[model samples]
Target: MGWLVGVVAVVALLGFYLTFTAKRVDRLHARAASAGRALDAQLVRRAATSAVLAEEHGEPDLYAAARGALDARVEDREAAENDLTRLLRKQELDSSEASDVAVIAASRRVALARQVHTDFVRDALAVRSRPLVRALRMTRRHGAPAYFDIDDPTLPSVTQVTSRATRD
Candidate 1:
């Protein structure tokens, strides 16, 4: 009987230990998934700035080119996330380690995307503030055509006509 009692106690202790460990594993897994989603959200938000904000600056060509590049980088980041998730699952990595790797990968892309967008914005702003823009605006306000050769395609048809008259 004593031997049986001892066996029962050991079994109960083992059950409790297993339950505790399983709960801990579950918590960690939840944290990893949540962290992955958070990182993805940050990446998405940063990716949008170049498209939405830059378009307002009257830079269609620059906006189109940058938007394309940003879209590609964002897709690459998403694929990286998917690959990391697959790696973690296949390797049966610890939940904490899986979350850490995902966070790091997302962060690297976020930093790069933000840096590129920031540089583009800075250049656009610098160009907006140049003397040429101000001078041209002043000329238009004074009812004088901007001081440019008529062959520039951006010039209006009426302005181009004036240029044609001068040449003829």
Candidate 2:
């Protein structure tokens, strides 16, 4: 009877240990997943801001460096997301530094993208319109001669032997 009771007590302790440890593991996994989701949302917002700057500038070269940086940030975000899932499965810290590096890279991208857009908007030729766009060949040709042919006989050629320079 004594031996049987000892065996039963050991089985009950093992059951409690498995139950508590599994719950702890699940809670840690959940925390990691939430952190990863937050990081993804932040990176997505940064990428969108970069896209807006690119569109506003019209010239990709104006923001190519910044855009490339943003792309690297996005790649990092995606890698972080993937690593979160992997960590959940493998329960390891081998890739946590990589995720940290990704966040740093994204922060740098945001700063650079902001600076490039600011400079571009300030120096942008398209942004300035000191003179309105005038149609060259349109009916309202301001600088062109009123007549169709400059040498038309009916209109009298100005460039004939009767040079305008001589007459003037």
Measured with C-alpha atoms, the lDDT of residue 121 in candidate 2 is 33
Worst window of 10 by summed lDDT in candidate 2: 147-156
Candidate 1 segments whose C-alpha is farther than 4 A from its true place: 57-75, 78-168
Candidate 2: stretches off by over 4 Å? 52-168
Cα lDDT tens digits for candidate 1, 76-116: 55443333233322222122343333433444555554444
Worst 10 residues of 1 by lDDT: 147-156
Colliding residue pairs in candidate 2? none
Instruction: Evaluate residue 38 in candidate 2 and report its C-alpha lDDT on the 0 to 100 scale.
Output: 51
Clashes of each: 0, 0
- TM-score per candidate, chains pooled: 0.37, 0.34
